[model samples]
Target chain A: MLRRAASILAISALVLLVAGMGISAQADVIVIGEIAALTGPTAQQGLQERNGAVLAVEEINAAGGVLGKQIKLITYDFKGQPAEGVSVYRKLVQQDKAVVIVGTNFSNVNLAMAPVAEQLKVPVLSNAMEPAVTTPEPGKVNKYHFLAQPSSIEQGAIVARYALDELKFKTAACLVNKGNSFATSQAEAFRDYFNANGGKVLDYIEVPAGAVDFKAQLTKIKASNPDCIYIPQYAQEAGLQVKQARELGITAVVLGANTLGVPPFVEAAGSNAIVAGTYFINNVHFGDPRLADFMARYEKRYGEPVITTNVFFGYDNVYIIKAAIEKAGVAEPEAIRTALENTKDVKILQGAGTITLDPNTHRPVDMPAWIFKWEADGTTVPMTLMYP
Target chain B: MLFQQIVNGISVGSMYALLAVGFSLVYNILGIANFSHGAMIALGAFFSYWIARYLAVPVPVAILASIAFTGLSSALVELVTLRILRKRGQGSLYFFIASLTVFNLVTAVLVYISRGNIVSYPRAFLSGTFTIGNLYIPWIDAGMLLISIVCLAVLSYVMFKTRFGLAVRAASFSIKAAQLMGMDIDAIIQGVFFVSGTLAGVTGALLGVKYAVYPYIGNFVYMALFACVVGGLGNLTGAVLGGLLIGLLETLVSAYISSAISPALTFAFLVVILLLRPQGLAGRATEEKI
Candidate 1:
């Protein structure tokens, strides 16, 4: 009886302590929640995104934060799962009481959380590149969801146009991963654009997800003798495809989405010589003079060079949120949603210096994608920025 | 294109063969499928990667060292899981579950260590392709085929021509009878695990060289399992044949039919073959061991 009473007393004390801490946490701060794939296959990208968000929050607080209050960023790990993204969104909105949420460059994760964001009535500034993340349908928009980058369709169309008009590739072949929506969406856009604009699509091969080998498909593609092969796969898969294509003596110019420009793609391809001359769409040109300060600060803070373009997404998402809250003139979810919808000419560190979300689609308007070529020495040479 | 696709199939087949032979060795002796072979495959890749990266050793030396390490790890797994279960007189089902748990645990541990980042070997090791007329064969693929043949040859010689081979075969025939005849069943099981582990280790290292190294490379175990199943489960030659056949079928289906549905087509072919011959291509009609 005495032991039971003592246990009850301990449990009550713990509850009181938790409640007190919760109340204290709500004081003098605007809570902003972030969901990222912190501990899964894409953890590196997620962590980079988190780091970028943290850096922006620190900078904002250092400069006497928005609306006379410091922003308290609460980050949750979605672990690269879509279902976890929904739960995390609910927790952030209902439990944490965050006025705005920033996060996740993964299109699927952002897509999963879009409906929940609408239900919860909190504005989510996402870095995901899927068009459907914001505008789920042609005419309808998810009011609370906003994208910080150009959609995958835009990226694909831009690459296709650049290949046809700039490189003068008359015939093209597309290698797509059927299981990944990101790859499929990009590949479809590229194919449609390329076909509609004089260039003939020789072979359109779709491989399953987790397929490491591409020799047989490349051999078939080689038979067609296309001028260029557009492979819109993730980094590792794209790396393997390019390497295998070169091995099969398919010397046609290789084109890919942004994933091919990352370190993993180079690493997976095994050598610079193998990947040399491959063209890929990029989010940011790493050698851009304007990005020098941000890169230096990131390297200084993280003790490593900025690895991927996700840093820009994370950094820009926080700044976008801050701009929204400031524009709203009140630190409420509904007001922030309105301000984000009307977001125009906000300065952030990606694509042509400023972001203006097309309130209709909730995606940035006239956003340009940078095209980069892999040099023989493994360094990426930024060629030109193509606007959609 | 047909010839090139065939070459591609054979190249991929050789990889599946390497993994299948290892998996078959364990199933031959113990009717249970030891899923921990998957963990050993992953460990083999990571071990070689760690050695080459941190010790800064040459690639060949690192591979050899990792092979030995993985062999010991396989034996350790046997000691901790299978041997304990055997002593307890438990069913193979328990070992199956335990082996799967080990596979997941090791992969999770690797995910933590590598931070889920896919990494390649620090230095170039067989990192280029060579062409033959219109045929483009990567040095890594050729190397893997040669290595697979040599490993199979050596394994065959050991299994058919050695005293240890006699003991192992005796145990497979009947573990109780073998023990009654004074054969060390425990030692034989440990030996089989070690050999299988070495095969897994070599496969992992070569796979890392072929593709980039990542934690989930153990997913290759599924192909290995498929190879073993399609081959006579206990038949070594059947395993190789099944591996090559599956590789050829996958390549051909993708080349001629549809890359999108190639996996489904390949599995459907497997189902047809199994329905036609339940004993597998090389397996003889016999009573179920388990």
Candidate 2:
């Protein structure tokens, strides 16, 4: 009879322990994950992303939380590598139990994470400009990844149009980093658009990544005597190319992708004069009245002035996730994925208009790419906003 | 256009020559690749940049000071890591690994300090290009070429003419024989390291001016390794020849062929050459005395 009593006690304890585990697992907190290159060559942009997301989460949490549950952000540093990016995506989903994910400015990393997102049944909102991150093949969607910024396709054509219609450049030469899919996609898009629009693309040069010296390629471009040179690369290479181009006496108008507008590009160029008259296609519209408040709050929170467009991306992506979660009305991964697909008319701090993802492509639609010209004082002045 | 490309090649090749020769120096004596040489290169650049920017010293003086400091640091690295390992009777592989560890540790520290930002000099020096007929050459490239030639000449004189050079050469033949002849092996090894470090330092400073200063700027050591291997790993003259050839090939290939595949093509070419002459271009096969 005593042995039977002890057995009953052990069974009751096991049942209570299982019930407690379930209760704790269903605690009143919503988990979200952010993956970024927090410590690598692109850390500057990553730092901005982290700061922006942190600010958004704080504001949301202070405003009585989202769906009556305090939002908890789990951030992972991929260190700018695609392999690490995949590993972190798994950790965020499987380990952190996050319902929705955001971040990664690198196109390659985003591309690597898309398939994993689909398998994990989690939705990823990325700022990576590569169109392939959402649509891996033409007319085929990845069903999980969403892009918050204008794709490289739109930005490239906008740049080409601005060059030909606004600046009236007759001939151009394209220089791209072959190693970077982001750069190559933009370069190729520009080449296609320029050629289709009756502009002469004198030569398309694919430069190996990390080739600090560009005199050899610049000499060939100079010999060709094009009226303009299109450089689509990240800030480090962009600054070096412009500085070297000016040194080599290539007086052609310089056109670049969005990455060229960052402070690192200016810092890398050394003097503002070298970058003066150079224009790059960007999504940020500094003159937009909505940004004044955002900029002020960002500075107050981070103790540093805004330097890159990535800050906007970080802030906007979090709002995108929040909107999806509210629409879903439940902190479940599958429900959030479904809700994210139906997102429409969401407001965010980027582009010249509201953020809306195309239901079919999972990419931002009708977003305008603005042309920004570098001033003599190391500031970028917005010239005109163009839409695809 | 051809002349201009050739000029560009020479400018690029000269930088590689400085690095390869310095890299070959330690290898000739120690029979091991000193990977820390890359860190010394990065340290040299950062040192010059910091002095020139923060202290407001003249660029030339900054370069000299950086050269001295980096040389001493290189010697110190040898004294601490390799010297200790050698005293412990470690194999060549341990020395190589320890050198690599030093390189990685230094790079990581630089990354932490700089926060992964690429910085240029506060004031432009050797910037802008001057035209000679139809050929346009950036002043920085011209300066690098001139400095590299002068350094090579001085190094050649020291290695061929000086008593210290005699000891190094003797030690290279046989460390045991040199010791029996009353040579201090430790001192000779340290001296070689100092000389090698000085070369790496100047190269680093020039490279920083030409490009931008970043933690990963030391990756140029790959070019040095390639040149050393192609020219016969321990032959100084071979290193210079190999550097110029590789530089010229890279320039011409990128100019005429697809830049995307130029590096791959260059590596393939190196492989073919290596297969043809396993001892490399200038290496002489020497039998062990047993």
Deviation of model 1 at A75, angstroms = 1.5
In model 2, residue pairs whose N, Cα or C atoms come closer than 3 Å (at least 3 residues apart or on different chains), thus clashing, are none
RMSD of each: 1.9, 4.1
In CAPRI terms, model 1 is classed as high
Model 1 lDDT on a 0 to 1 scale: 0.90
> Relative to the unseen true structure, what is the Cα RMSD of model 2?
4.1
Tens digit per residue, CA lDDT, model 1, A130-159: 788888889999999998888889999999
TM-score versus the correct structure, for each prediction: 0.97, 0.95
- Candidate 2 local lDDT, B1-290, one digit each (tens): 88888987888888888899999999899888899999999998899999999999988889899999999999999999999998998888998999999899989999988888898888878988898887778899999989988999999899899999988998899888998998999999999999999999999998989888899988888899889888888889988988887888788787877677778988888899889976778887743320
Error of 2 at A86 (Å): 0.6
lDDT of each: 0.90, 0.88
Model number with the top lDDT? 1
Where does model 1 exceed 4 Å of error? Answer: A1-17, B288-290
- Segments in model 2 whose C-alpha atoms lie over 4 Å from true places: A1-26, B287-290
